[model samples]
Target chain A: MTNIKKLISKPLFLPIFCMILVMAVNIIFDAINGNFALNFFTISVRNGILYGRLIDVLNRGSEIAILAIGMTLVVSCSAGTDISVGSVMSLAASFCCMLLAGFGVSSTSSYNVPLFVGVIAGILLAGVCGAFNGALVAFLNVQPMVATLILFSAARAIGLLLCNNLIVYVRVDSFGVFGGHLGILPTPIIIAAVCILVATVLLKKTALGLYVQSVGINRKASRIAGVRSERIIFICYIICGLCAGIAGIIASSRITSADSNNIGLNFELDAILAVALGGNSLGGGKFRLAGSIIGAYTIQAITTTLYALGVSTEQAPVYKAIIVIIIVAIQAPPVKAFFARRQAKKAALKGGVA
Target chain B: MKSLKKINGNTLLLLITIALFVVMYIAGCVVYSTKGFTHLQTFLNILINNAGLLCVTCGMTCVMLTGGIDISVGSLIAMDCMFIAVGIEKWNMNPILLMVLVLVIGAVFGMVQGFCVGYLKIQPFIVTMAGMFFGRGMTAVICTEQVSVSSSELFVKIAQTKIELPFGAYTNNKGVLQVPYVRIPVVIALVVLIIVFLMLKYTKFGRSLYAVGGSEQSAVMMGLDVAKTKLKAYVLSSVLCSIGGICFCLNTMSGSVQQATGLEMDAISSAVIGGTLLTGGVGNVIGSFFGVLINGTISTLVKTNGKLLSSWSNIAVAALLCFFIILQSVFAKIKEKSK
Candidate 1:
């Protein structure tokens, strides 16, 4: 009983409970409203909702989930948050598109070289951008936000300039096939799964993950203990960049074109929101990859649900803002502590009365 | 020598800005004289048109000096434009009343953000970012669409009236190079700059802002009301942003959500280029004014050249931002080494 109580008392346990409760409430509300129908027999089918929409959500969520994993690491370092992840993603895509175009791979081409080269170039360029961010924050000791903001503006401009402010559509069969689903599973899902497995192994089964947590918990103490804090921070940024690059490739492929202006716009905010919603501290320390992935799904689900309910596009930002507020408020330390203390007080009062 | 060193960081940035201006001016003169472009007038117009950005940047510097940031300023500007458009075009209200209303709204928005950040202990970035979303969202809800002041007599007067100097030539082809009436908004902006500069340099609140930003823990131990100071700084920033927005509307005679889409970045870049440390506590309102001018001139140069894409303006601004940040980082290192 004590062990169960302790488990229930864990910080993340409450949020997970809240998430489940919310999902359940939403499901019940939808059912009562007659928007959903479930059959308990051998085969179940939905009449109103489309399977394509679900696939779309999964494809979109997968890329963001992959990037969020890397963002979690970067945020776990004492270094500041990167708002330039979207810009980095765009830069990667633009570079990839440019490289493909330069290689005489027309939009009508059936060649696979463009697809292979684009992915590699995109990831490499993203790594370089990440390395630049790391150098500014770690070596130069610049604030993370400032260092990243500079690149945020510069990198996006560079991307747009390279692409000449136009959408670049690559017509490679392999590229389209790469984004295609294997039976019922999407390519992005496969990529996300591989990323998550690798990330989990690195963070949970290695000393590097422990060092990252230690550095986040106490930079001075970690440094004193002979941890290469700067190097770790650099690596985290590189990972973030690489993840963003991969996400960009997937996103661009899904659209079948690289949009210089709108590609990966405000993705960093989504990634940060996902990480924060997962109950991770912005001040650094503990990280939960599973929680982060759930948070991404939760956000995507909320948007999808809202859209399905016929919410106007113009009002979407307001709803998104409200949801973000609720999520942050729930995660706020004082709010959480207040609830915990109130529960404790209630128990104590009952005991006293008894 | 000590004082010089102390101000050397600011001085170096100022010198670089002046050099850039000189280079741009020389380039502009050479290009215009050679091309004899009719669009040279448009270049001047662009510079005059962007004076609102200068005002916003000036306010941004003040808030940033207090170790706080206000992304909501962009939204505040949007709100200001909406209110001004409604006041003049819909309600047939006085321009002064519109200005006052915009300023009040800005103050309230800033206060709310400040309350969350200062009193509630929410992170400044998160609070301001939320405020940004809230402000912009509310503006869209209220306006529902773009609002234009094309029919407003006062707005037209403010926009069209321009003062001409004796030193410049007048031509009918350009509708007179000089006018008797200077832009009232520009004059207001100038007055605001002077007042803010005085307050920052000579007031107790200003000193406290610097002290708090220098080190919050130390300021608290010193018995300064750090929260109040920070709150006031944000309020001041919002008010300035509103006024800047009004100025922007007066210049363009229109209000739209897209009007100041990327103005926040411009303001931030200007503040940084003007030698305001991103880490906070050190900045000058005057420097930010020059930073805006530099930005305005870059776009002007591009427009006057006619051969270059306007997108190059963003590239130039980004380059300038990087240069200033790198210089500041180096200066900070030097200061640290000296210490």
Candidate 2:
């Protein structure tokens, strides 16, 4: 019982539980439809690729998952959400496609340059944008949201200009490999995994995680303790930009085009939501990277569940809002305190009776 | 020079914004003289086109003064427009009643968000973001198609009612006298602007907002109710936003799910560019009004150019936003140094 209680008290437990609860909805849904209750868990291989609703969730969730990795670090270090990730993603994709398709050539069947050159250039550009935001926030003392808001509005417009106000398409088969399947697994899933693994290793294997957390908790104190708080924050923003770049590349590759208007639209909000849902405080402090990864997948699961239940695309957001409210309300400080008080009262009463 | 040194950070910021607007307007006049940008009518047309934005910006200034933000305004405006359109064209309900209903909905929406943010201590961004999602979803639920107020005579009359200016009449290329006129929405927006300005300047509630935003801990020590102040600020913002939605409806005379998609960003940017600090405690409706004009002028300038892509306006606004932010920071540093 003590071990169980300890497990329940773990910080990651809540996010994991929330994810399971979201998936459990599928069980009831399947039962009601007279199918096997475990139908959602069933995964079958189709022509050397994974096929299932869960697989769909994983496949579709890659961009957000990768974004959440960077978002987790930024939130932990700076205590501010980067609202420009979506636009930066769109911008990166546009730049990559523009480079690959050779400027104003809207559509092309071959690479204008080597594929890796365009990809690296796209990610580097996003990093540069992130550096600008980091400079504003860390050095100039601008609020993160305010600093990022500049890119939030300007990035897409800049992307449109880069693409000559057209959707640039690279039709090469090699171009789709990033978004396509790799050895019976979707390439996006692998990319997201690689990003998460690299981020995890970087944080855990070095003192970077401790530095980020200490800075987040108290910047002045950390500065006094010999931590370059500003540099850490700047590095986190660069990482976030790189992550958004990768996600942007995958997104454009999936569609085989750089759609300036639609690529990664509203994704910044989703990435933020993923971080929030992962049981991390937006105020910045200690963070659980695992919780954030789970949270990202859970969001995709919710969308998938809504679709499988036959909810229309237009109506999905309403249900999503309701679900988000319930989850956040459960995690709210007042509600937790209330529950703790009630539990303490009951325990005291039971002791007195005994 | 001594008096200038004594002018304070807030006023200095506002003066910078005013100067920037004047300079930009003058530059526009010089560059686009052939396009009649010098006409007084051109200026009034900016007001006419951005009346909804002006109202929304005023509301944004209120919430921003309290160090809170309400990004749900755009989605709420879209929902309001859809509601108004459906009420008049489909349900045949009286337009006035529908307008009242939208205000009530706005109040309720704001209250819920405020309760969550103030009482429950949820982050304001999260609560408002959820509100944004809910508003947009409700809009789609209400109607998936474009619904216009074409058949409703009362609505059309209200939308088309022109308040012609006694002056600013110009002789056109056709050799006829042309009078510049604004629709009813512009008058409503100006009234709202003045009312908000007065309320922010004179009312106890307004003073409390500044106190809370300036420092929550200090406000608590001062025996002010921070939560209630935040709640009221949000409620006022939403109520005013709904009014802006009505003006928006009057301007468009149509409702679609995608209506006013990014208006919240526009309002926030305007408030910021107008020298309203995002961290709160310093802003006014007049500054915000000029911010709207500056944005409107940029779009107009781009349009007059005709060769430039429409996206250039967004880039210009962003550059201006960055400039103001950096300027505000520099002023902050100077104030700190002097202290």
Candidate 3:
């Protein structure tokens, strides 16, 4: 019973609770009126696959979800957040689009390469970029934030140089099909799920996660313990870069075009927030993949709810900022202290009354 | 040789920065002499155009010296400019009063963030990210569209007026070559730079800032109010950002929701380019002044070359930043080796 209560009172509980509560509100609103309608639990088999807003949220969330996975690893490895993910994702998106485009920027009739080839090329490039950033931090001993800021500023410039600063429209029937429906569900959700599964096994089921956590906790101690801490940190950044590349491919395919300025904008912040919402320490150490996954769902739910609430898409950030501030503030130490004091007072008053 | 060895890392960095400026300008003078790029007016133009950037870079330098960062300064500038525009255009508030009020508001904003970061022990990035959101969101809430100041006679008068330099002067009928000059914003920026230099150099508060940044435990042992020093640093940063916002207004003579987007990065980059270490305890304000100038000159060169993409400027800036970081790291390593 105490354990159940503790689970309910855990820092991770609020975000999950908030997600469900928001969905319930939207459901109730749907029932009352036709406007702002979002089906919370109308899952049914269609064409031998799942169909529902829950699935939609999962599908739409796969981009941030994948980024969050990479972010979790990087944070665990180095105790530093990478803000360059958004821009790196753009660079990947540009690569995918440009590879698919093949010829000059003029026509759709131009023969292009296969999807897997583009995917492989894009992820490799992104990984190289990530390794550059990692080399700066790991080998050169630069702080991760400042080191990543280089790529954050340069990634888009490189992306522009890739496509010659022109919007390349690739209309491969299979290119757009990358994000299309698989059976009845979204392809992104499946890819994201697979990625998460692999990540979980790599972290929770292997010794790498332990090394990462120890390094994050104390690099000197980890090094003393025979861990190649720099190599671990470097590999972690490379993983993040590859994951960002995957997210970019998913996004560009879904939209059918690569817009360098808009792809993965502010995603680093969202991924970091998701990690926080998962109750993982930003200072880095122990982390839970399950909690971070739930946090990703919560983010998707919030964004979907805002869209359904009729907020202009561009201005969604305003409402998101409010929600994020509230969520983060509530988790603040001072606020938690205040809550603990109130809870204690309530218990004391009840005891006196009894 | 002993004196050379005695030179500190920051001084070495400052020397490198000066050398870079000299090399860059000489190159600029060589390549683009056709457009009168070698003139004294062109040089002052860098200071005038980047006056706002100078202020914000100085602000970033201060916060970094205290081992903190305010990523929201860019957004805060947007909010500040918008508030001023609305105050002057819609409410008809006196320009001077609006400026003072905006400065106070900015200072209070910084104070709250500082208190959270210092007294409450919140991470500076998270606190300031929230601050960014609030500042940016508030601007949108104010009005999503552009707020022009050209309608206000006083604003137009202030913005349009240029304190002409003799550098732009041509030889008249008397064949006298006159020296060129600068505008009001440049003048204000120079004054602010001097004041900041003095504060960081002579004041106990300034030295305490460095002490706190170098090692908080030692600073505390040395009887410095670590929290207060940090708080003051933030307050000074935001106050300067507000003043920079005003200068941006004077430069563009308009305010919008999207004004100064990603400007905080430029300020930080300029400071880094100027030789201020991002890790804190190892920078000076004067270096940051030269840093902004370098960035401005790059942009100026790009403008002069009609064929190049403007995004190329960011590439150049990033390259310079990476170079300096590598240099600073090497310098630190060499110093450690000598020891």
List each model's interface RMSD: 2.4, 1.9, 2.5
Cα lDDT, all candidates: 0.75, 0.89, 0.83
Q: After superposition, how far is residue A22 of candidate 1 from its true place, in Å?
A: 4.8
What fraction of the reference interface contacts is present in each model, in order?
Answer: 0.27, 0.70, 0.32
Q: Candidate 2: where are CA atoms >4 Å away? A: A1-5, A351-354
Considering TM-score, where higher is better, how would the candidates rank from best to worst? 2, 3, 1
Across B1-339, the per-residue lDDT of candidate 3 in tens digits comes to 999878777888898888889899999999998787888888988988899989988888999998888888988999999999888888988888989999999999899889877776667777777777678878877778888886677777777777766346775346887567676778778888898999999999889888988898999999998888889989999999998999998888777988887787789889998888877888998899889999999999999998988779888888888888888778777877999
Estimate, for each residue in B1-339, the C-alpha lDDT of model 1 and write its tens digit. 876767577677877776776677667767676554333344455446766786788788888887777766777787788778877888888887788888888888888777766765666776676666666666766666788887667668777777653443545455755432346676778888898899889999888888888889999999999888888888888888888988888887766665576677788988888778887888888778778877887877787677776678887997888778888888998888999
- What is each candidate's DockQ, to 2 decimals? 0.44, 0.69, 0.45
- Compute the lDDT of residue A180 as modeled in candidate 1: 62
Clashing pairs in 3: B165-B180, B165-B181, B166-B179, B166-B180, B166-B181, B167-B179, B167-B180, B167-B181
Q: Candidate 2: what lDDT?
A: 0.89
Residues B201-229, model 2: lDDT tens digits: 99999788888888889999999988888
> If chain B of candidate 1 is superposed on the true chain B, what is its TM-score?
0.89
DockQ, candidate 3, vs. native dimer: 0.45
lDDT per residue as tens, model 3, A56-93:
88888998999998888787777778889999999998
Better of 1 and 3 by TM-score: 3
Quality of candidate 3's docking, in CAPRI categories?
Answer: acceptable
Name the best candidate (by lDDT): 2
Off by over 4 Å in 3: A1-5, A8-11, A28-38, A43-52, A103-109, A322-354, B89-93, B166-168, B171-181, B337-339
